[model samples]
Target: MYEGLMQKVMSDSKSKAGQYFTPRALIDSIIRLIQPQPGEIVQDPAAGTAGFLIAADRYIKDATDDLFTLSEDQGNFQRRQAFRGTNGCPTPTAFA
Candidate 1:
């Protein structure tokens, strides 16, 4: 999923400008420094190809052992609520 988005971004000339792909080491370092906790909302306004989101998601899941296991609809609801009330962005929905 993320690869496809990256491909599309790379293909778009306008979007590609100033859009160097984030290296894995940099992402890993950021994740380690941030140390996102489970159920703690995160967002990146310039989430090019969702690299940060994907990394943060993986970090949170690994940290929490996948505790936030709500159904898709319920997850969406919680996500919306978090964003509306706290301006916190929810994790991406997991597709079945």
Candidate 2:
């Protein structure tokens, strides 16, 4: 998983990664607190490796039973519009 990769990269070097990547635990905790829905617009401005955005999407999918509970339009929105990173960030999130 990309999260594993980032954690590996972080552990490999005591020095900080090129981009400021937040810890997965903290991100997941925040997502739990927020409880993002399928159609809400979620954007991370400083999306190093898109970790925050990815976690948010994962949280939403998990809550919605992998989007099975959502309507077609809501699922489409989750797939296309719910998760967003900054302009320079790569589209590295995996919804499934």
The best candidate by TM-score is 2
**Per-residue lDDT for 1-96 in model 1, tens only?**
664555555555524354445666788799899987544667666564556767776776565455366566545543453221121223221210
| Cα error of candidate 2 at position 56, Å | 0.8
After TM-score superposition, what is the CA distance of residue 59 in candidate 1 from its true location, in Å?
0.7
Q: Worst lDDT window (10 residues) for model 2?
A: 87-96
| Candidate 2: regions farther than 4 A off | 1-18, 87-96
Every model's TM-score: 0.55, 0.71
**Candidate 2 colliding pairs, count:** 0
CA lDDT of each prediction against the hidden true structure: 0.55, 0.72
User: Where's the lowest-lDDT run of ten residues in candidate 1?
Assistant: 87-96
TM accuracy, model 1: 0.55
